[model samples]
Target: MKSPSIAKQLKRDRAFVLMFAPVLLYFILFKYVPMFGIVISFMDYNLFKGITGSEWVGFKYYAQFFENRDAFVIIKNTVLLGAYKLLFGFPAPIVLALLLNELRHAIFKRFVQTVSYLPHFLSNVVVASMLIMLLSPSTGWVNRIIEGLGFPAISFLQESEWFRSIYVLSEIWQQVGWGSILYLAAITTIDPQLYEAARMDGAGRWKQTLHVTLPGIAATVVIMFILQIGHALEIGFEKVFLLSNAATYDTSDVIATYVYRVGILQGGFSYATAIDLFMGVIGFLLVYATNQLSRRLGETSLW
Candidate 1:
């Protein structure tokens, strides 16, 4: 059969198109429009002069970033922190969703989900404060327990070595539950008959999950994974800023915090813009590479 004409299709889906108009406008306004500001990376940007009047000094700021002595350290810290987050945070929601899906008790499952999702609604500042209080070297429950066990009280926030682990764990705590919402929704899309077939074959819950559930949601999982890789470097600034200090700078200093210091605080606009542009390019490449790899490996990907 011949496909309907564009006009006919639009007429048939008019209500749906009306509903989608605001979303399209939002991306065009906030997301795409702001990207045009990236041109500042190539110029000596000035508040007084603005974009059009700013002097063009192409690649100067980029070269300066590479020449700086602390460049390597900051890059290494950003990469390691991003890698650890991806390694740990990526699978957490998948595991939680699967566990929750297996529950036979509706009330209990909902209660557990509600408790898990509440943390994601908390402000970053509040989360950071909670972590600091809980891990305080003095007058904190954790340290008190350590002392009771005949060990010296350790300051987790002050130590560079513990920063990555602490950050990853806290991130998982805040995000895992809310993140699982997508996977849970995907789980509902699987054919119920598939589960019946698995049971007919004498498969247990574990076997059904392995053979039926995982494969059913594999496409959603791959898409989410690729999107996660795209933002691996774009760590939120609020939590890191509140948690980090001079003592933890060696391990906790990420690109976002550094950008806040040099760009927003110190007013080195062009230099900071250059660094951020580099990060954006890296993230874009990550998404592209991962998408290509996924397609090659017979998995779904973001186009």
Candidate 2:
């Protein structure tokens, strides 16, 4: 039989199309449309002159950024923060999903999931305030415990050494449950007979999880990992900005906050745009490389 015409197919799937229309419009309006501003990175970007009227100065801002004294430090801080978050945060959801899968008590499992997921919905501002209150060297619970052990209270937010750790841990705590939702959904798609067969062969829970559950969700994990790698350099601005102070700038300053300071605050639009565009290109390259590597090593890839 001949395939339905385009119009007929659209009519048949009208409900699905209606559901997706808003998302498509959103990306066009917020994501893709604004990409045109990238050209400002190569221009002087006068506020009144605008894109067409601005003087073109190709590579000048990029060169200046690279030549700056603080460039290396800024880049290093961004990379290390991204790497640490990826290293710790990537596995957290997977571990949570596996543990949750083993739980037979529905009420307790849902309670744990609900508690873990609640932090993800909190605004960055609130989370930052909570962190400050919880880690205060003077009256914070964390420091209280430390003092209880006869050790001196440590100012976690003020210290440069603790910035990355604090950021990573907070991210994991906020996102682990929400992230695990995908893995849990993937686990449900696995055939039950596989688990039953494993049981028939005297395979324990751990063995079933290792051999069956993990492999079942391996594709989802790979896709998620690849997507995470794509955003390795694109850390969110609000939480880091709210959490960081001058004392912690050495470790906490990242590309997003740097762009905000330079582009929005200092009015070096071209210079800041150049830095952002450069990082975006690097992120794209990382995603491409990771996807290519995944394709070669396994059946899973973003493509």
Candidate 3:
């Protein structure tokens, strides 16, 4: 049989097609068109000269980046921070969703969820400001409590040792509740009959969660995990920039902040672009490899 004409198809689903038009235009304009700028990473691109007049430098910038003394340090800090965030951030929502699911009191559960989720709405500047205020050594409430307990008021934000921990915890506080919404949505799709069967089989809450609830939502969990791993390196710029100072740069510096400092603040565009391209390649590889692994092991993948 012949396929329907484009005009006929549009006529049948015109409303849906109209809704999709803006999304299609958005990708074409903002996403696809901007990909052409990646070529500038291979060139010593000058703003005045433009991409066409820019000299082709091949991989010189990339080589320069790798050869820098701080390159390894910066990359190490980025990887470590990203790893810490993923380690603590990924599983937190699942645990929270399970707990939220178990709450029999609707009013209490909703109140808790609402309070938890509110943090996600705050801008990075606001969140970072709050962290700075809370972690302040002299007048901060946290230090006040510590001093009351007879401990010295050690500066949390100033100390390099505390940067990673503070960053990860703040990220969790800001994101965990929002992340749980997805897991909760997945949980609702689980078969009600499965829970009933588990109860009949003498399964307790924990046992049912282990055997039934987890397995039922396994695909969603695995997919989300793979995506998380894929973007493991693309840490946010705003929070890190706001939270970091020269004293705490040892642990707080990540690639995004590095790019902002070198590219935006210092105007080392070509070098920064090379570093960004390098990170993009790694991120792409991570996503592809994880997707393949998920397909093999769990038969679930973004593809």
Pairs of residues at least 3 apart in sequence or in different chains that clash in candidate 3? none
- For model 3, state the Cα shift of residue 120 in Å: 1.2
Model 1 TM-score, 2 decimals: 0.82
Query: For residues 107-221, could you state the per-residue lDDT of candidate 2 as single tens digits?
Result: 9999999998998899999999999999999989999999999999999999999998999999998999999999999999999999999999999988999999999999888
lDDT of each: 0.92, 0.92, 0.91
- In model 1, pairs of residues that clash are none
**Global CA lDDT computed for model 2:** 0.92
Q: Write the per-residue lDDT of candidate 1 for residues 1-303, one digit (tens) a residue.
A: 999999999999999999999999999999998799889989999999999999999999999999997678788989998889999999999999999999999999999999999999999989999999999999789899999999999999999999999999999999999999999999999999999999999999999999999999998898788778877887888988999998999988888888889999999999998998898899889878877877776756666
Candidate achieving higher lDDT, 1 or 3: 1
Task: Name the TM-score of candidate 2.
Answer: 0.85
* Candidate 2 ranges with C-alpha deviation above 4 Å: 1-33, 288-303
Candidate number achieving the greatest lDDT relative to the actual structure: 2
Which candidate, 1 or 2, has the higher lDDT?
Answer: 2
- How much does candidate 3 score in TM-score? 0.87
